[model samples]
Target: MELAKIHRLDISKYNLTFLPRKEEMFAEMLEKVDADDAVLEALKSVFPLPERNTDVLLHGDYWPGNILWSDGKIVSIIDWEDAWIGDPLADLANGRLEILFQLGKDAMIYFTEQYKSVMTKVDYSNLPYWDLWAALRLSKFTEWELDENILKTMKERINWFISQAID
Candidate 1:
């Protein structure tokens, strides 16, 4: 619930804000991925995410890379440029995808379950939708810098998550 603690903060004085919906951004990102008809159809109805009761400060670009280590302990977190005030799920979704890609599906599942346990105060209906959002966030990766096998596995994982989301 570390993230939720930040969300629970009163950052109203900062005047931080984010789009009420990500439809425009996702629409443009569509061309980056080879999504099928079912996925495309699902996108149409997933807009304006099932917003939770309140918005909070988000480390929008949270992931492994942003975390700094010092003697095996987390010392700091960088990359605050993408910070925004929005649904807590947005950052959770980003971290989930990062774990899925950087670690693996099992790790991702463990991480998600742990997050859910910590975040029991909020409704979870937005989770599946956030999962889809996380999957699509990777869709915009065009560099393909990973090894062939790794890339293939990531694609399979992404597809699996997408199928789960669309269902």
Candidate 2:
């Protein structure tokens, strides 16, 4: 999203923040995480609540692999398919899951803390919604992967997605 508009340009009216009020987005994540039902249910109720962050620049797809490094130093971030104008926390939440799985949990925590230090206006509570949303997308990918394979592998991935919630 346009973090600049929210912070630098001071344009909040055109922003669109979507944190849905349901577990459907998050179900795949809860399946993989085995997140407690009580917690997910509570989040289902709270996920739709709004937290505006006008100035935070979001990388659109802030996942770990997207954040490029060269010779042990940071270079550039890639992938802008989902980039838009909205809450930066959504990107943070979406990026966190990819970081945790692709970069390891410790690094994810470190990056989160580092990002937290730079955040000024927005609360990061809406992260779960974003996390769930990404998980659902992953589940769809899993479905597509299943379809591309033969009977056995297809069955396996399908079962995995079902166990994860998008089958």
Q: What CA root-mean-square deviation does each model show from the true structure?
A: 2.9, 8.4
Give the Cα lDDT of each candidate. Answer: 0.71, 0.51
What are the runs in model 1 whose C-alpha is more than 4 Å off? 17-36
lDDT tens digits, residue span 64-118, model 2: 5676778976576677655554566656665665565555556767877877766
TM-score of 1: 0.80
**Mind giving the per-residue lDDT tens digits that candidate 1 earns over 74-156?**
77889887676667777888888887878988887887787778777767777677777666666755466878888887788
Q: Which pairs clash (backbone N, Cα, C closer than 3 Å) in model 1? A: none
lDDT of 2: 0.51
Lowest-sum lDDT 10-residue window in model 1: 17-26
